[model samples]
Target: MKNVFSGDFTQGFPFQGNMTGNDPSGFPFQGDFSKSETQVKPQPEIFETNDFVYVKLPMPNKDNKNLKLQHTNHQLILINYPKENEQSKYMLPSPVKRKGTRARFLDDYLEIQFIRLDESNISEIDISY
Candidate 1:
């Protein structure tokens, strides 16, 4: 019986003899990944500091009069943006209070600042196991 852990174990595999000479990383597949039709749309940038959570989104060819912004504790919503009657929703990094939100549109970018909600009131539960 042949040992499966031997060097020749890959002889009967489907990827056998499929290694390409031009691939420096020695991957078994061959394809020009750079020519692939995978395009990435612009995504919102989110960051949080000690006091605030910031979300910056690109608003190319957009106007403040045509945009509407709304938010809950966990999500931020943009309406009438990028196109008429179209809306985009973004998730916030942390829970935010509804009162202290500030939004500004400048230089083709929409920046929203949300005050972080205090979540440090965790209580220890006694397990009755």
Candidate 2:
């Protein structure tokens, strides 16, 4: 089954539950994750109720309070800039209205919430007419 993210990829590339080691020939990929430079961003679990849109961003070891949330042109922009590195950006899979965009920091993660000012509906914005 696909995840909330949609698409077959949501099922993820099937893991053996505790299997390590890849193709010795390295046909597809190489390098061990145990010694990798950067890591793939973990997908956060987003829960939507009748009143608000909850987006949980998983980022650790940084001051989450510094993170910012804003909406421009109806797109939810999450800017997380670390003091020692460049700023990171994540896009909400679904469009978010700017009506009431706010965020909270807890447990090293940033929880952004958007108020459903215009009902929990997806409106397609088409400027080409």
Candidate 3:
């Protein structure tokens, strides 16, 4: 018998799943990961020429008006509110300024521009800084 444990086709090394079928019984999150599983990884494009950081959120089919942008002394919070999604808030991973920030609503996408001031920003105010 071919050792399933030592073979590449086995579920030991590159494990696909224990089930033979696509729809596993006990396993969850097999399909439909476009929603509720992961948030659109915020893509921040720093426009040094314009002194503004253009942020593009990859939230497809989501209402642009529902998106909210807020910044604290610690991190830049990008809150995305989908009309069809449950109500909740998400804190951003980076610290950015709230002031001078602008947002625009596009086709099912929200494009925001965070003005990077030449002066001290929220990140600079960190205690460790």
Q: Please report the candidate that would top lDDT against the real structure.
A: 1
Shift in Å, residue 70, candidate 2? 2.6
lDDT of each: 0.80, 0.59, 0.52
**Where does candidate 3 stray beyond 4 Å?**
1-50, 62-66, 80-97, 120-129
Q: Which stretches of candidate 1 lie over 4 Å from their true place?
A: 1-41
lDDT of 3 by residue, 16-60 (tens): 454433456434445544436656544543332446566555567
Q: Can you write out model 2's per-residue Cα lDDT over 16-62, one digit (the tens) per residue?
A: 33344445343334567552655545567677676677778766766
Give the CA lDDT, 0 to 100, for residue 113 in model 1: 92
Ordered by lDDT, highest first, the candidates read 1, 2, 3
Predicted candidate 1 versus true structure: per-residue lDDT over 19-79, tens digit per residue: 5434535556656644235434469999999999999889877544878899999998888
Off by over 4 Å in 2: 1-27, 31-35, 62-66, 81-87, 117-129
lDDT of 3: 0.52
Q: What are the TM-scores, per candidate, against the unseen true structure?
A: 0.64, 0.51, 0.40
Model 2, poorest ten-residue lDDT window? 19-28
> Using alpha carbons, what is the TM-score of model 2?
0.51
Question: Candidate 1: lDDT of 27?
Answer: 55
